[model samples]
Target: MRYFLTLYILAIVTLIGVAGFRGDISRKPPIEVFPDMDRQMKLRPQEPNAVFGNERSSQPYVEGTIFRGMPYQDTPINTGRISGTTNWVETNPIELTVERMKRGQQRYNIHCLPCHGASGDGKGITSKYGMVAVANFHDARLVSMTDGEIFNTITHGKNLMGSYGANINIEDRWAVIGYVRALQRSRLATLDEVPEAMKAALEKE
Candidate 1:
């Protein structure tokens, strides 16, 4: 028993020494005596298994699962419409305030500016890549689109655009919409729309 105990201790010491000693650096998985819970009885993404008939690990969401953080609020502000109607809300449901517009401008710069140019001219930096045409906000057709339609487009996305609904929260999305409208106005603002004082200054220049 004494001899066996001595041998066991020596074996443990040897293992510790081997682990601590430096060797030639190479890309290799280290030896694991006990990888506790490292390998679990769970399916990874896209991992094939014969468990289900479909053999897919990823499952669809169960029915009636609302994704928003807050509980379902059946309103045009949250759903962007009057429950069953396809008609869009003519104007933004959120109050048009300077603070909200500022927030919208910040969110737009972070998300929309990559595809829609700062001036909403469809000349964003990413446009140089092989992407489909981005719509210019100043275009008469887009300008004519109702505010709710524009909000729906941002929430669900249009051609060549992906939905931002998941990425941006509901209120921020509205803010972004407001900022987009502001951009359109900046480019399409008529001389009559300018303040008299600003117009006079521009005329002098």
Candidate 2:
């Protein structure tokens, strides 16, 4: 019993010594101490500004420069006749034959009719809800336009129309122009101009 009592007293003294050491260390100042500096003298890296807001302080790029791979330049635009040779060769308008007209009609119906109406009357579904009005190809102004002019308009849209250059290829644009002319002709074609044989063939079909 005396031996066990001595062991307990030693254990109690060791725990008290450990606790006293911990308390002494806790009362002492921390090893790391930070000094408060003046706001102006503080060295802080500035953050990058957002791209959109505060335009006045933003940097501007040079104007009239052309980026590689783009067709257009930022230079002053001169709306004039296109100079130099073009793939658009001048040819007599295709004959208003049924087969040729049918091809044009098919192309127009698929790509154009939804926005320009089946009659080319500019009453297409998109036009009805669209902010800008679509042109009526049947109008005298458009009907009198040359085939090349019509083709250009289709390739690079005029006024409020967006360009179809990407959507429809050059050949298809010409075909659609031919079809527009055919539609105009159909609206104004006289009875005398309609051949007797064509009338008979159409009736049989």
Candidate 3:
């Protein structure tokens, strides 16, 4: 009984030592595990500093400069619309070459597969974890959407989706759209669309 009582007192002391003063205010500076980050010598925005000739911590963006790996124009490639018009383009402005399609596949696997799925069926891994309303490329509405409209969706995002324009470059954005079209076509394609060289083997089956 004595040993247990002593142990209980020690445990209470330890608990109080660790947590009793958590909410108390202290004047002394707290010990920092990483002092460099805790006291970083960095400029704060909108604050006056002597670093620049203007003595301003915040500076205006340089003229004629766009964000790196981004496009900010109304051209067909950037806007995914008819040049100088509000209408969406029916076709991708960039040529959908084999290389671009391959690149699309790669980029799609990285950025899209997590939510859009490998088949573009919107049944990606996230769906199992309660992510809802992922857009399925095979849907009729998406099938009928113009390539430019799809590009716009990727650039600006829609509904629950967020903008990928900052993340995906212009060329690659078009490439991802091209790859999505290919995925949609995959489910709708007929035997006639198959290559003559491989038609014999499929027909034999």
Total clashing pairs for each candidate: 0, 0, 0
Global CA lDDT computed for model 3 = 0.91
How accurate locally, in lDDT, is each candidate?
Answer: 0.83, 0.66, 0.91
lDDT per residue, candidate 1, 143-162, as tens digits?
88888887788888987799
TM-score of 1: 0.63
Candidate 1: the clashing residue pairs are none
Clashing residue pairs, backbone N/CA/C < 3 A, model 3: none
Q: Compare the candidates by TM-score and give the number of the best one.
A: 3
Per-residue error at 33 for model 1, in Å?
A: 26
Give the per-residue lDDT digits (tens) of candidate 2, residues 70-159.
654221111112434343334324445567567777878988887889999988888767644788888999777767667666667888
TM-score for each model: 0.63, 0.49, 0.66
lDDT of 3 at 154: 87
Q: Give the total clashing residue pairs for model 3.
A: 0
**Per-residue C-alpha lDDT of model 3 across residues 1-205, encoded as one tens digit per residue:** 9999999999999987755677777676776889998888889999999989999999999998678858456788879888778999999899989999999999999989999999999999999999999999999999999999989888889999998988999899999999999999999999998999999999999
Number of clashing residue pairs, candidate 2: 0
Clashing pairs in model 2, backbone N/Cα/C closer than 3 A? none
